[model samples]
Target: MKVLVTGANGLLATNIIAVLLQRDYSVIGLLRNEKSFALEPHENLILHKGDITKVDSYDALLPEIDCIIHAAALTGQDIIDYSVYQEVNATATENLYKSALEHNVKNFIYISTANCFGFGSLDDLGNEEKPIRFPFSNSLYAKSKLEGQEKLLRLAKDNPDTKLVTLNPTFMIGSYDTKPSSGRLVLSAYNKRVLFYPPGGKSFINVIDAAEAVVNSIELGVHCESYILCGENLSYKEFYQKVTKQLNQKSSYVKIPKFLLYGIGYIGNLLRFFKVKTDISLTNVQTLCINNFYSNKKAQEKLKLQQRSIDNGISDAIKWFKLN
Candidate 1:
C-alpha cells in the first residue's frame, strides 16, 4: 500500500515513516521542507514538498495514496498567532477531509493530543469518550487541534467509505527530534537547565510505541473511533530524577509555588497585550500546571499496544541529542 504522511519532518512522523518502511509499504511524505531532517535513501520512500493546508499543493499526490497519517500541526509554547493555528490545524484538516473523500482514501489516521480531554486526576484518568472540556476556552494550541479532530470525526460518521481513526498521544519522548521540540525537556533535565519544577504531573509515552500504535491502527483500528495513546504518569520531580539518573547527575530543584506560576501567566498575558516576544506565555504556564494523566486502556486492549518505562524514552532521546 502507498501511504501519504503529513508533517513527515516532525519527530513522530519520522518514527512512523521508519515503521511503515520496515513493513514494506510505499511512503510519500507531504512535508513543508525536504531538508529539515536527514533521512536515509530508500526505494520505497518519496518526499513530496508541499503545504497540507493548501489543497493545490498536495492535490496531485492524493490520487495514488491509499492511506494517510495526518500528523501536521502548529505546536509551540511561544505561539500567539491564532490565525496561523486555525489555518494549519483546523481549516487545513477540513480541506484534507474533502480531498480524501474525492480521492477514495481507504484509511485516514488523525493524530490528536490528550490535552483535549482536559486535566484529570490519577483516580479518574482522561478517556477518549469524555467530551472535551471547554475546548475553545483552552489554550490556542489545544483548541485548534480539537477543532480539527471534531471536524474529522464528524466527517467520518457521515462518510462510511473512508475509514477514520483518531489517536490522542500524551507527552511523547524519543529519538529523531531534529527540531528538538518535546525532547528539549529531556535535554533540560539531563543538563540541569530545569532549576525549578512544576507541581503537576503528566502522562508520558515513548515515541516508538506511539508510532507503533499509529501503524497498528491501519489494520486493527475501527472506523469513527478515538483512542488515547498514553503511558506512565509521573510528577515533574520524578520525571527529572529519572533523566538525572540516566545522565549521571544530581537531581535537586526548588519547588515553584503554583501561585507564582499563575502570576507568570497573568503577566505573560499582560506582555501579549503590549505585543511582547516572550517564551513564558499563558499557554506554556497552563501546560506546566495542568495535570495531564490519561489512560490508554482502549489502545492497549484494542491495538495490542505495549508501553515501556519513560526512562527508556528519556535515555534514547538523550543519546540521540548528544550524537546529533
Candidate 2:
C-alpha cells in the first residue's frame, strides 16, 4: 500500500519510515524541507515537499496514498507559539483526516502523547477507556493534541471508509534524535553536564519499539480507538545510575528540588517580558521534568508490541550520542 507519512524528517518519523520500508510498503513522505532530520532517502520512498497545515501543500499528494501517519508536531513541552502548534498539531490533522475521507484512505495513524494523561504512578496504567482529562488538562501542548484527537474521532465516527487510530507513547528514547530533547538528558548524564538529577522519574521505551507500535496500529488497529504505547518506569536515581554504568564513569550528582525548578519557571515567565530565546523557559523545563509513569498494556496487547529494557535503550543511546 502507498502510505503518506507526515513529519518525515523527525526522529520518530525517520524510524517509522525505516520500519515501513523494511516491511516493503511503498512509503511517501511529506516534508517541508529537504534538510529535515525526519527526511528519509530510499528508492521505495517518495519524498514530497509540502506543509501539512496548508491545503495547497499536501492536496495533490493525498489522493494516491493508501494510509496516512501523522507524526509531525512541536518538539518541546514548552509552547513556542501556540498558534503554530494549533496549525501543525491540531489543524493540519483536521485537514489530513478530511482529505482521507474525501480520498478513501484505508487507515490513518495519529501520534499523540501520554502527556495528555497527567503524570501517574507505575501502577496507574491508563487504558483507552480511561479519561486523560483532569486538572492538568490546562497545559498548552496536551490540550492541543487532545483537541486534535477529538476532531479525528469525530471524523472516524461519521466516515466508514476512513480508519483512524492514535498511539500515545511515554518518554521515547532512541537513535536519530539529533536534537537535545528530554531523551538527550540521559545522554547528557554521560557528558558530565547532567551532574544533577531531577526528582521525578518516568516510563522509558526504545524509539524502535515506539515506531513498531505505530506501524502495527496502522496494520491492525481498531478504527477510532487510541492506545497508550508505554514501557518500564523508574525514579530519576535509577535512571541516572543506569546511564552512569553505561558510561563507566562517575560524575557529581545532586537532587534538584522541584520547587526550585518551578521557581525558575516562575522567574522565566516574569522574564518573558525581557524576551528569552533559551529552551529552559520557565514553562518548558518544569512541565517536562514533572514525574509521571503510564501503562503500556493496551499497546502490548493491541500492537503486539515488544519493548527493550531501559538499560539497553540507555546504553545504545549513549553509544550513539558519543559516536556522533
Candidate 3:
C-alpha cells in the first residue's frame, strides 16, 4: 500500500512515517520543505514538498495513493485568530477528503486531538461518545479540529465506499520530536531543582503507540468511527515527579493555585488585546486546572493499541532532546 502523510516533519507524522516504512508500505511525505524533514532516507519513503492547505500542490499524486494520513494541523494556544485555525484544520481537511474521493483513495485517517471530547475524572474517564466540554470548547484549536472531524464524518455518510477513521490522541511524548513540540513538557522539569506545575492533569500516550494505532486503523478501523488513542492519566505533580525520576534529578514540585493561574491568564488576555501573541489565557489556564483524563478501551479493543508505560515515553524524549 502507498500512503501519503501530511506534516511529514511534525512529531507524530515523523513517527507514523517510520512505522509505515517498517511495515513495508510505500510512503509519500507531504510537507512545506524537504530540508526540515526528521526521518532518515529509506527506499520506501519519498518526501514531497507542498503546502497542506493547497491541494493543487500534490493533487496529481492522489491517483496512485492508497491511503492518506492527514496529520498536519495548526496547533498552539498562542494564535488569537479563529480564521487561521479554520483554514488549516477545518477547510483544508474537507478539501483533502473531497479530493481523495475523486482520486479513489480508499482509506483516509485523520489525526485529531483528544480535546474534541469531554474530559472526565480518574474514576470516570472520557470516551469517544462524550460531547466536548468547556475550556476546550472555547479553545480555537480544539474547536477547529472538531469542525474538521464533523465535516469528514458527514462526508463519509454520503460516500460509504471510503473508510474515514478519526483518531483523537491525547498529549503524546516520545522521540523524533524535531520541532520539540510536546517534548517541551518533558524539558520543563528536566534537571531542575524546583518544578512548578498546574494542579490539573490529562491523558498522555507514547508516540509509538499512537503511530501503531494509526497504522492498525487502516485494516481494523470501522468506517466513520472515532477512537481515543490514550494511555495513563497522571496529575501534573505526579507527572513531574516521573520526569524528575527519569532524569535522575532531585526536584521539589510546587502546584500553582488556580487563582494565580487565572490571574496570569488575564494578563495574557490583555497582551493579546494589544496584538501580542501569548499562549497564557483564561481558557488555557482553566484547561491546566482540570482533570482532562480519557479512556483508551475503545482503541485497545478495536485497534489493538498497547498502553506502554509513560515512563518509557519520558525516557525516550529526554534522550532525544539531549542528543538533538
Candidate 4:
C-alpha cells in the first residue's frame, strides 16, 4: 500500500510514518519544507514538498497514491480571520479530498478534532452518531474542521470507492511533542513552574496511540466513520500530577476559581483591545474551564485503539523533556 501523509513534521505524523514503514507500506510525506524533516532516512519513505491548498504541485503524484492521510492544519484557539482558517483547515481539505477522489485513492484518513462538538463542561462524550452543534461563529478553528468533516462525508455519497475515515482526538499527549499539545504541562509541572492550573477536564490520547488508530482505520475502518480517539479522563490537576510524578517532583498547585479566571481573562481581552500584550485571553477562559472528556469505545472496538497508559506517556514525555 502507498500512503501519503500530510503534516509529516508533527508529533503524531512521526509515529504514523514509522508505523507505515515498519508495515512495509510505501510512505510518502508531504512536507511544507524539507528542513523540518530530521528523522533517520528510510527506503520505503518518499518526500514531497507542496501546499495542500493548491493541488497543482501534486497533480502528478495524486493518481498513484493508494491512501491519503490529511493531518495538515493550523489548529489553535487564537484569534484569526475566518478566511485564513477556512483556507488551511477547510478549503485545503476539500481540495485534497477532491484530488484524492479524482485520482482514485482508496482510503482518505482525515485527522479531525472532537472540539467541533461544542462548548460545554458536561461529561457527554462525542461519537459518529451524535449531531454536531458548533458553539460559536467566531470558532474559526472548530468551524473549519467541522466543515471539512462534512465535505468528506458528503463525498462518500457520489464516490463510494473513495472511503473517508476521521479520527477525532482530544488533547493528544506523548513523545515527539515538538508542538507539545498540553503534554508540555508534564514538563512544566516537573520543573515546578506550572504557574496556573486550568479548572477543567480534558481527555487525552497518546500520540503513538493516535497514530496506531490512524493506521488501523486504514487497514479496517467503516466508511464515513468518525472515531473519537481518546484515553484516560483526568482533570487539569490530575493531568499535571502525572507529569509531576514522572519528573520526580512534588509541587503544590492551587486551583483558581472559574469566575476569577474569567475576570482575569476579561482584563486580558481589554488589554488586547488597548494594543497591550498580556499573558491572558478572555476568549480562552471558557475553553480552559470546561469539561472535555471524550469516549473512545468505538475506536477501541473497531481500531483496537489501545492507548498507552497516562503514566507511561508521562514517563516518556519526561525522558524526552530531559533530553531535549
Best by lDDT: 3
Which runs in model 3 stand beyond 4 Å of their true positions?
Answer: none
Task: Per model, state how many residue pairs clash.
Answer: 0, 6, 0, 1
Local accuracy of candidate 4 as per-residue lDDT tens digits, 121-227: 33566555665543333356777888888887887778889988888877777666666656556656755654469888778777778888899999788888788
Q: Looking at model 1, which ten-residue stretch has the lowest summed lDDT?
A: 129-138
The models' CA-based lDDT, in order, is 0.86, 0.77, 0.93, 0.78
User: Which residue pairs of candidate 1 clash?
Assistant: none
Candidate 1 TM-score, C-alpha based: 0.96
| lDDT tens digits by residue: candidate 1, 247-276 | 998767888888899899889988877878
Q: Give the better candidate number (3 or 4) by TM-score.
A: 3
lDDT of 2 by residue, 1-324 (tens): 988888887777888999999999998888877774543478899888887778777878778888999988875644545675677778888988898888888888999888776557666645566666443375567778888989898878988678889888877777767675656667667568447877777777888899998998877799888888877788777878878888887876788887888787777666655665444555555554655677787788889888888777777677767666
Best of the two (1, 3) by TM-score = 3
lDDT ranking from best to worst? Answer: 3, 1, 4, 2
lDDT (Cα, tens digit) per residue for candidate 3, span 225-266? 999999999998988889999988998878899999999999
TM-score of every prediction relative to native: 0.96, 0.91, 0.99, 0.91
What global local distance difference test value does model 4 have?
A: 0.78
